[model samples]
Target: MEAFTTHTGRAVPLRRSNVDTDQIIPAHWLKKVTRDGFEDGLFEAWRKDEEFILNRPERQGATVLVAGPDFGTGSSREHAVWALQNYGFKTVISSRFADIFRGNSLKNGLLTVVLPQRTVDALWELTEADPTVEITVDLVARKVTAPGVEADFELDENARWRLLEGLDDISITLRHEEDIAAYEAKRPSFKPRTLTV
Candidate 1:
């Protein structure tokens, strides 16, 4: 997981509510155990529509996703977060989010910002009117800001620290590697044994 601090980029506005994990990344994509390359499967069904925002060339390389209420609201698949990260979205702004999905996103260093519905609607409208609109997510200040709007958001302190440090679960565990090694070395009853006793 890459560390997330302040990110400013073109925003990808997904103006729909109740976006479930299955809709973000369908179940068939879960067959691969590896975490790389889920971007292809991200919103696979939605892409078939040809008019989906993700298909718009102007939105390419957008690092922020401005979405509607109750985003990421489905099965507890962490792949939804993976898909977003692989697809290069560093931050997601919404009116609300599913608890489990939010947690998973934080664990993977994907920033999920919950702003009031009014703020979200404003962003959606701006992005819709102009594809060049960009938003900045300042994690250090816990704020999201656009040309004519600014709002405060909240995140868990520990999650914020983990993202700032780009520390995943394994990285956290490795921080205590020396202590673990010493504990194993001190285990009792480790003498060599003879074939016959």
Candidate 2:
């Protein structure tokens, strides 16, 4: 996973509440075994509508997503996070997020910023008025800022550390490799085996 220190880019405003995982990436897209290529499936159903915000030419290449309340509220699908990341979104800003989806996003190095409804509304308006407006997310400072707008967002300390360090679960475990090896060497042979083999 790529480290998220600071990101500044145009934001795609998705002003719809209760955006479930299925809407972010349709269930049919989950058939793939690998994480790559899910970008084509991100918001597959919504993209069908030529009028959708994502289909707008001005919103093309947006790396930040400014969404409404209750974003990512639905089934526990990490693929939803994968789809967003693959689609070039490094951060998703919303007033609220489902617990499972937030966790998945953080684990995958996707920054999910929770701001007040008023702050989110202002961002949406700003983006709508000018698609070129750049939104900056500063993970080190725990802040999101845009033209004439700035707000602080909350993130778990551990998650923030992980992202800043670019450390995935495996990477974090590997940091303790030497200690694990030492512990294993001291283990008694009488200990029950975890695997039948």
Candidate 3:
């Protein structure tokens, strides 16, 4: 997973609430084992409508998504976070998010920002009024800001540290590699071995 510090870019305003994992990336897209190429399936169903906010040309290359409440509300699929990241969204801002979805996003380095409904609505309005307007999310400061809008967001301390340091679960464990090696070196010879001959 890539490290996330601060990101500033155009935000796509997606006003629909209760967006589920399946809507973010349909089940068919899940067949692939690799993380790449999921961007084609991001919002697959909605993209067919042509009028969907994501399908709009101006919304292309947007790195931030300002979505409605209850975003990522269904399923525990990590693919939802993969699709969002592959689609170039570094952060998602909403009033509320499913607990599982938020966890998945954080693990994959996709920052999920939760703010009050009023603040979320203001961000949507700002992005809708001018699609080119830039929104900045500062993880270190725990704040999201745009023209005439500034809101504080919450993030777990450990998750914040992981993102700031670009450390995934495995990377975190590897940080103590020297200690793990030393412990293994002192293990009894009769102890069950972890490796095959």
RMSD of each: 5.5, 3.2, 4.0
Question: Pairing residues by index, what is the TM-score of model 3?
Answer: 0.86
- Cα lDDT tens digits, model 3, 35-134, are 7889989999889998999888999889999899999988888989999998899999999999999999988899999999999888888888899999
**1-197, model 2: which lDDT tens digit per residue?**
78889999999999899999999988898888998889989999889999999999999999999998999999998999999999999999999999999999988889999999999989999999999999999999999989899898888888899999988798679989999999999999899998988
Whole-model Cα lDDT per candidate? 0.90, 0.92, 0.91
- Winner on lDDT between 1 and 2 is 2
Q: How accurate locally is residue 69 in candidate 1, as Cα lDDT from 0 to 100?
A: 92
Clashing pairs in 1: none
Mark the regions of model 1 whose C-alpha exceeds 4 Å error after superposition.
170-197
Give the TM-score (vs. native) of candidate 2: 0.87
lDDT of 1 by residue, 1-197 (tens): 78889999998889899999999999999999998899999999999987899988999989999988999998999999999999999989998999999999988889999999999989988888887888999999998888898999988788888888888788679999999999988878666668647
Q: In every candidate, how many clashes are there? A: 0, 0, 0
Show model 3 residue runs off by greater than 4 Å.
Answer: 171-197
